[model samples]
Target: MIRIAQLSCGAEYSGIQRELERAAEIVGAKMISPEVSLEDVMDVEKRFGVSVPSGDLNLIMARATRLVENPDLADAVFVATCFRCAEGAIIRGEVRRYIHEHSRLPVLSYSFTERTTAETLLTRMEALVTTARMRGLLARERQTGLTAGIDSGSTTTKAVIMRDNQIIGRGWVPTTEVIKSAEEAFQQALQESGVKREEIQGIGVTGYGRFLVGKHFDAKLIQEEITVNSKGAVFLANAQKGPATVIDIGGMDNKAISVQDGVPGSFTMGGICAGASGRFLELTARRLGVNITDLGKLALRGSYKSVPMNSYCIVFGTQSLVNSLSKGARPEDVAMAACHSVAEQVFEQQLQEVEVKQPVIMVGGTSLIEGLPKAMEDLLGIEIIVPNHAQYIGAVGAALLVSGMLEV
Candidate 1:
C-alpha cells in the first residue's frame, strides 16, 4: 500500500488539504499527516541549527522531516503551499529539498490560493496520486468473500450483510441483553440474505458494546464507532459524489465526523451528559404527554421562537419545560426549543473548534427526527443529507472494513 505523508501549515489550508485527500482516495493511496505544534517547531530550529523564518514554516518543515525519515510512516511525501505567500514558497522548497536529499522519497507539491476552486485542487491532486501509482508505489493483494458487520449501539443493535460490494440484507432490534441483541440482529440479517453462517468470510463489530459483541460473535475485526461511521459516510459519499461531514446522534452519545477521500479527517464527540442525545428527547417528550415519534412533526408547527434553554442537564431541562408549560407555552414551541437546544449543545460545546462543511450527512436514530435536522439546518445554514438507512450506517461501515481486510 502507498502511504503518502502530507505537509501543510495554517488552518486556512484545511479545506485545500481535504480536497487533496479526496483526490488521493480516487487513486487508491492512503494519506497520513502528522500534527505539528509551535513548541515542536522551536525545538527543531534550536536542535538542527536550521533557520526557520517563521513559526508556521518551522512547524511544517519539522513535521515534514519527521514523517519522511520514518520508513514505517510514509512511502512518499506531498506538500501544499499558499500561492502568493513568499514564506510558504520558501519553506516548501526547503522541505522538499531536505526530504529528497536525506530520504530520496518522491515529493509532489501543489499550490493553492484563497480563491482556488475545489475542482482545480482535485485535478492537481489526482495527477499527483496517479503519478505515484504508476511508479509502483501502491500495491495490495486481493481476496473475495461475503462479510458481516454488527453495530451494538447503546439503544439498538444493527447488522448488515455484504457480498460483491453490495448490501444484501440488514436487520435492527432494540438493545436489551448485549449478546442476545447482537445474535438476534445477526440471525435476522442472515436469514433475509439466505446466506449460511459457514459461508460468511468474516465478521466485524463496532459501537458502545463492540468489544463484548465481538467476543461473543468471535468477530475477526473490531473497531471504534468513530472510525466505522466515517468509513460508512465515505462509502455513501462515493455514490453521491462529494465529501461528507457526518453527524451521528445515537441514544446515549452524539458524534461529528469529517470524511475526506474515503477516510476520517477529524472528529468530535459530545460529553458524557445524555442531555444532547436521543434519550433526552424521549424523556422530555414523555413528560410533555407526547409520543417521541410525534415530537419532530409537532415542532415544525410551532409559531413561537422561545429563548434558548439555559441548562443542558436533562433533569434541569425537563423542569424548565414544565415551568414553560405552566406559563402557557405551546407543546410545539417547547419541542422545537428542545431540538434547538440539542443543536446548540452540539455546535457550541462539542464542535466549537471543528469546521463543519456541506453536504452534512445526518445519521443514527435521532437523525430520523424531522424537527432536529430542520433545526440544525437553520442553525448551520447548510442542507443536511439524511441517508435512507441512517441508523444502520455504522454497521455498514463495519462491514466495509471487513471487506478491505479480506482484500489485504
Candidate 2:
C-alpha cells in the first residue's frame, strides 16, 4: 500500500482524523504520521524560519522536517488544518509548499470543518494516490492511437476525438440527461471525425457523471478532474516538463491545481458559493439582457471600479446587479464587476491553498470568456495561457490518457 504521510493540526482534536484515515483507506492507501521527538519539535522554528505559539503546530512542522529529510517515509503528503484557524491555514500552505519543493512526494492540502466527511476528501485522496502510483502514465507526452474522451460536467457535456495526439473533431452542448447528453456530444464528435465507434481503440470518461457515462460507453479509464484536467491543460499548453498552475472555473465549482513535470502536486476544488463560479456570470448576463458570450467583451469595454459586487453569495450578487442598474450603472461596468467578483473569490477560496507557478493554464468553457481570463490575469499579475481546445479539456485529457492503455 502507498504510504500517505499525514501532517495536520487540530484534526484529532476536532474529531475528523478518522475521516481522513478512512478516506485514504478507501483509495487503497495508508495514512501515517511521521515520528518526531520533543527536541525536534522545539527546534522547528529555528530550522524552518517560521514560529507559531501553538505547540501542536510546532509539532506538525517537526514532522514536515522529518518527511523532508527522509523522503522514503511517505509516497505522498496530506497537509490539513482547521478551517477556523487562520494561523493553521498559513502553516498549511507553507508546509505543503515546503514538501513539494523539498521532495518528490505529491502534496494535498485541505481545510477541514467539524462536519467534514470521508466522501468530501475521497476525490482528493484518490487523485494524490493516482499521481504517486501512475507517474509514468502521467508523463506520457503523446497519444498513440485513435481515442475518444467524454466530459459530462454539471452545466455542459463535451466530447473530443483525437488521432495520433491531434484533436480532429469536438462536440459541446448544455447538459440535460447524463447519458443522453454524453451520447449526443459523442455522436457529434464521431460524425465530424468521420470515424465509427468501434474504430476508436480507447475511451475515457470524466466529470460529474463519469461513472454513469463510463459504464454506458465501456470506458477504458474513468478519472476525477484534478489529474485529468491538469494533464490536458499541461499537454495542450505544451508545458509538460515544468512547474505550472491550472485554474478551471466551472459552472458549479472551481479547481486550482499546482503541478510539476505534468504531474499534479497540490490542488483545491469547490467553493463556499456559486458566486465564485461561471453560474454567477450566467445570471449576470441574464440580468444585463445579453448573451453569456457577450458578457466578457462587454466587460472589456467598461470599468469594474464603478460598480460594487457581492462575491460571497449568488442571490446577493444578483441583487447588487439589479441595484447597480437601478442606479444607472453601465451594463459593461456591471459585467466587468461580475468577472472581477468571481476571480477574487477564487483567489481567496482556492488559489491560496497551493503554490502559484508560472505559465498558468486556464481551461474549461469559462476560459473562453474574455473577461474572466482577463480578470484572472489582472489579479495574478501574470499572463495566463488559454490553449487550443480549452473548452474540451476533460475530454481531451480522457482521450489522451486512455490511449496509454492500448497495446502497442
Expressed as tens digits, the lDDT of each residue in 1-408 for candidate 2 is 989999988899889989999999999999999999988998887888987998888888999999999998999999888897999988888888888888889998888988999999987898899999888888877987899999999999999999998998799989999999999999999999999989999999999999899999999999988899999999999999989999999999999999888999889888989999999999999988999989999999987899999778999988899999999999999999999999999988999988899999999998888899999999999999999899999999999999987853
Hey, what RMSD does candidate 2 come out at? 1.1
* TM-score, cand. 1 vs. native: 0.66
For all candidates in order, the CA lDDT equals 0.70, 0.91
How does candidate 2 fare on TM-score? 0.98
- Prediction 2 global C-alpha lDDT: 0.91
Q: In model 1, how large is the Cα lDDT of residue 246?
A: 80
Clashing pairs in 1: none
Summed backbone clashes in each candidate are 0, 0
